[model samples]
Target chain A: MNAPVPGTPEHFIANAKDRVFFAFDRSDLDESAVKTLMGQTAWLKTYPNTKVTVEGHADERGTREYNLALGERRANAVKQFLKAQGIADARVKVISYGKERPAVIGSNEYAWAQNRRAVTVVAK
Target chain B: MIKVLSRAWGRLGAALFAVALGVAGFSGAARAELRIDITRGNVDPIPIAIPAFGGGDEQSSRVGADLAGVLQADLERSGLFRGIDPRAFIQSFASMQVQPRFPDWQAINAQGLVQGRAEVQADGRLRVEFRLWDVFSTQQLKAQAYVTEPGNWRRIAHIIADAVYERLTGESGYFDTRIVYIAENGPATKRIKRLAIMDQDGANHRFLTDGADLVLTPRFSPSLQEITYMSYYNGVPRVYLYNIDSGKRERLGDFPGMTFAPRFSPDGNRVIMSMARGGSSDIYTMDLRTLERRRLTNTPAIDTSPSYSPDSQRIAFNSDRGGNQQLYVMNADGSGVRRISHGAGLYATPVWSPRGDYIAFTKIAQGRFFIGVMKPDGTGERLLSDGYLVEGPTWAPNGRVLMYFRQTPSDSRGRGGDSYLYSIDLTGYNERRVVTPVQASDPAWSPLIP
Candidate 1:
């Protein structure tokens, strides 16, 4: 591996917010999510070789099988946003962890608010 | 992925036998003296006296006591019978062999009396016989004799309990069944879930798979020792079929994208599951023998958790085609689809009862999850219980009860998250927590063992 550079994935993650949150059972990206994706859009356009993967997640309020689909919708919602912002389709992929993997461990609203999210991962 | 772990995995191979003892002219018109109307919501537990089965020697006597104890436990656990204290018994097991002194049982308020005997055969096998008598009527209601391997006493005990239960209540018993479920442990963020199976009474607990990868939603075949479940092995979700007896397992199919929430058809000839492609998912079925796949539902919305009716004629699944997740029913050939759940909330996991009368499902309303049942045409919907996150209702083989997993919410730091298996009567009366070695979820009860 080469030395750290300004256009590296680490730099892209540090400068641009790589994640967005969603409300309960909702897939539509809010204004804040758009702002986060706009930040990532600029970084992805600059780093032509960098391919990002959008990972969607859900809260534990739903069944395991349904949450998987919900997570996919959330991830695709991010992918659609990036495509609208001039990010090519080939540079971005998507996956969903559903409720199987949660960002926060608590069962409260504060934790769920963070758990229901989509993250743009800079693929190595 | 055909990993064979030796073939011909089986049970007590033709050696076990159960014959009705003294069944000549057993009165079929006799009324139940200690009757339980299971059709109703709740009933008082019947008091029954189970004296130890008489045996000739010490070892046989020990086995006899164990058999009687297990039989009593199974009946008591059903919430239908109360075992009288043996210390208050006025008659001995030997005396009960000839006939039970009706007054002695009536003195203890016992409406029923169960007496049996155990003897070690010359070939080292065991012979266990049981007789169920109505204390007030002074007549033998049921009697059966089982001869099997010496170590197969527990199963025989369950069978005897089933016979007695059927004799008392007009319905078949679920004592001889097994429950396959996901045994969850570890932290909230990274839970280790392993496939585990156990007897109905929490005996014979064992894990079927190591927790190397994430596993979920284990469902047993209606007629075999096989189970279909999903696993995220190598970071790709695939449905797998595992045999409990042989310990051999294989990937069910190689679909395009993630294949999950797999359940066998009622006859165990095929598997129905959800395969996700892009942002949405759809239901698909794969023949177990040919590996031929058939798409059941074609929609952009999520269509998953497909379960078949007992007759395999209709499928009741959960779909979001109508904007929100609710129950849907379709013909076996994927024709005539209609929404079955008109409730204002989301419904998932629609498991049809073995008796083909009602469909059990998990519903999310307001901010709570509930275990509920509904008829095939979506009528008579009833919520059995609701909680913070109660889901996955599986019907017992007899279809008179349901077992599901209930999880209590954790604290802010995820300290007190507790999950337990619970069984509730179909009439919504007896709700009892099933004992498990670890935190459990996604319980699927096996059909009554042949």
Candidate 2:
């Protein structure tokens, strides 16, 4: 298949920076995550046919299993916010990678803060 | 079972070995005792000499050397005995079976001596005979024989070391045990983790699960042949039961919500786990035989990481019901709830020790993590080890040692981040890193195998 053209609405939805971040061990979206999610919702509405997968993640801190549940809560929170902003529930899927997947690769707070995130990826 | 050293002196102790000499027909008494009188809680390791075994054929000779090496490593790692350099040994292996030249050992300042002989029988079984001697007392303290299949040479070595430790310190040995942990690979963002098991000393290492999906927090059952851990097999995190012998996997619960942080009951017949639903987690127990689920704790906060006492009478766990993360204790039925930890930091993973005297916990404060233990009522809390990231403390079967994991910081580029498992004595001394083939975390030590 031919590669999709860059800078399309779908492309913006799939961008890594389109992710909504949360504080440590929390699922509620902060002001920064809310601003990012607004931009994502605007682009997502431009392409009505676009389906997105909301993937939730956690920083490597607490117990492994609890982190997983926390990740799910983050993803669900993101999904609920997106749907309330006019994204259809049918077009959104949610999954949690837990602490298994981090956006940054360090043990410090900076890395952990960056890792606690949820990204809306355009489904292929 | 033999006590040769008097406790009143408190400076030295004896090393005794009780073996199945009846099968080997070695002629002397089945038990031999020697007195050295070393104290139990010495920081400095007692200098000891262990010569290679004699009278083994080519194959047995190789096995014998490996056995001796493993024994030496076990003793040294315990922080109780230091093996002297073989190059300084004046008595040959052949001379060790007979009366050792006490003068030669004394010249090197050796406090104790261990000598053994190995032979492969006509039936293809290997027989190992060992003797412990007190160099200062110039007396043979203990001698015994072990007969087992050739493939089990390492276990035999561990058994020997345990006997020596028990005889000397008047305490049970923890050498003949296994540890299960999460082995990690890949970069920090997308780390791959698999359940791995190995001998206490990192020998016979093997992965129990392929890293197809993420697995973590593996805990051995009271019986050594099975384990309980959390896995995301189908993209839904849940607790699973894995049989070590048959390689079978079974899901513990089909709860609509996530079930994680599972540990076997002290009786090994039920599993105590935390089930998360509706933005809250609660501790629950499920009978293995009947699949009956019992809710032990029902609070709004994240009440997880439940561990049972040795007698299964009380449960110790971590919860946020007290406003912040702290340790709490309640009856097995979730009654008589009381807070145990009032420390300055957030406490997670409160494991009731197997000996029922203390509760091990991980404390996070001021961006640093600490492994500490306290009494059941939360008094006398002493932090054992502190680091950039240290957590997941599990007690050894004997409850004299605690093992946990520590993670070092990685640079902004995500370079140099590594995690290692460590063990420390209950007194907060003799901390040793448990070496694994790769980065490891969440260590769970098994009870001594039957």
The lDDT leader among the candidates is 1
- Each candidate's lDDT (Cα)? 0.87, 0.81
Q: What digit string (tens of lDDT, one per residue) describes model 1 on residues B1-450?
A: 122211232453435677667743224535446667889767889999998877888988999999889999999988899999999999886733476777888898898888899998887889888888888767787887877777778788888898888989889999988889999999888989999998889988999889998889999986657989988787777889888778898888778677888999988899999887767889999998898999988998999999999999999999989888999999988899999999879999999999999999999999999999999999999999999999999998889999999999988778867889999999987899999999999899988877
lDDT of 2 by residue, B325-366 (tens): 788999999999999998797888989888899999998888
**Per-residue accuracy of model 2 over A7-108 as CA lDDT, tens digit each:** 464577455356877887778888888888888788777778888777878987765555666777788888888889999988877776777787887777
- Residue B247 lDDT (model 2): 87
Model 1 chain B poorest 10 in a row by lDDT = B1-10
Error of 2 at A9 (Å): 10
Error of 1 at A100 (Å): 1.6
How many backbone clashes does every candidate have?
0, 9
The superposed Cα distance between candidate 2 and the true structure at residue A40, in angstroms, equals 6.5
Q: If candidate 1 were superposed on the true structure by all CA atoms, what would the RMSD be?
A: 4.2
Q: Against the hidden reference, what TM-scores do the models get?
A: 0.94, 0.87
Q: Is the docking of candidate 1 incorrect, acceptable, medium or high quality?
A: medium
Clashing pairs in 2: B11-B37, B11-B38, B12-B37, B12-B38, B13-B37, B13-B38, B32-B141, B33-B141, B34-B141
Error of 2 at B356 (Å): 1.4
